[model samples]
Target: MQDNYQALKEAGAEVYSVSVDTHFVHKAWHDNSERISKLEYTMISDSNKELARELDILDESGKALRATFVLDPENVIQTVEINADGIGRKADVNINKIKAGKYIASHPGEACPAKWEEEGDDVLTPGLDLVGKL
Candidate 1:
């Protein structure tokens, strides 16, 4: 996702990463890892687990589960994705979802179908006349 930070920004989304680690630990890891060092987004320290508890993503082991949230301008959560430990996330998938969300937000009543790409013609605007057509 670090590599696509600019693309996310261009799509009018700000990316932030929240972790249970302290700021010092985060800084150390950022400094040591080449990939982490390349990230230009905000890194939040949640050592107290306030965010994790608030989001209800804390596991039984007292660790935060991997999660992603997409929020609108008013801070309303538009989407939420949570994964178990050791599972990885795909940035491209999140990017496409964000794009679809934005498109739907602007063009109300329209929906994007599977594999819909930005600026593509695969969007569907449902109506009673097309109830059984799709």
Candidate 2:
């Protein structure tokens, strides 16, 4: 995750990590895990799960599911990924999605769909007028 965070940083994007763990546990985890300790992004501790609730990351079991949100510069949620506990979590994919978004943003008349790739055809401005074209 930190690796991806660093990549995003290199790309001139802001990144942050929010955890449901308490500040003490979050601190302990950071202190114990050498990998996470060197992170440049801010690690947010939400022991009360305020952010988890707001983001709807918590499942019916009352446990926060592994989730990811990609927000645009305006803080608008552009992508959301949530999964059951079995799936665990990975930040690389989300980082790639962010990269795709950045590319689309820079190119203007473009947008990415699920599982987008660099070479995929971006939506042209005129194509947008054809929305619902089957």
Candidate 3:
């Protein structure tokens, strides 16, 4: 996500990485791992699992599950993606989701389709003509 952090910000979103690890561990990884070394976004340490428990992503082992939440300006959850242990998240995908969410928030009574990606993409306005067509 570090690679596309600017794209995310331009889409009207702020990026924060939350983990159950301690701040020292996070710093260690950032120092040791090449991939994490250049990250400019905030990395939150949720060692007590307070944020994890609130988000309901904590596992039985007291670890947070692999998850990403896209919240709007109001702190309303707009998208939730929970991945299996072996899965990884795509920065581009999250960027698209953020764009879709922003569009929907600005245009009331409109909904983004499953494949909506950007500002020009089509949106749905629920009405009689679109009852069962989709």
Candidate 4:
């Protein structure tokens, strides 16, 4: 998560992380890790699990499920991913989608697809020509 966070920071995006853990534990994790010290974003305290439950990203054990949400600059949710309990969350994927959303929204006449890249097509034009390609 920290590694992918650095990538997002490099891409001119602000990254915020939330955890179901207690504030003390979160602080301990931050204190124990040198990499986390360099992070510029907020690591939110969701000990009550309000955010996870609200997002429907909470597990039966009351822990935050591995999930991601991409929000446009205006804070509209653009894309979301909720992973299975056994699967790990790939922060890179979320960062990429956030980047894509930023790029598409700014450029207009554009949309992204599964695992999109920078050179990928800007989709959803008035004509259906780019639909299949995207």
lDDT of 4 by residue, 13-69 (tens): 677778888879878878998877766678888998888898988878777887777
What's model 3's lDDT at 52? Answer: 95
Residue-level lDDT of model 1, residues 14-128, one tens digit each, is 9999999999989998989998898899999999999999999999899999999999888999889899989998876778878898899889999988779886667888888
Off by over 4 Å in 2: 113-134
Q: What are the runs in model 3 whose C-alpha is more than 4 Å off?
A: none
Cα distance off (Å), candidate 2, residue 100: 2.2
For model 4, which pairs clash?
Answer: none
Q: Give the deviation of candidate 3 from the true structure as CA RMSD.
A: 1.4
Model 1 local distance difference test score: 0.89
Off by over 4 Å in 1: 126-134
lDDT per residue for candidate 3 within 18-86, as digits (tens), equals: 999999999999999998889999999999999999999998988799999999898999889998788
> How close is each model in CA RMSD to the real structure?
2.1, 3.4, 1.4, 3.0
Say which prediction, candidate 3 or candidate 4, comes out ahead on TM-score. Answer: 3
* Among all candidates shown, the one with the greatest TM-score: 3
lDDT ranking, high to low: 3, 1, 2, 4
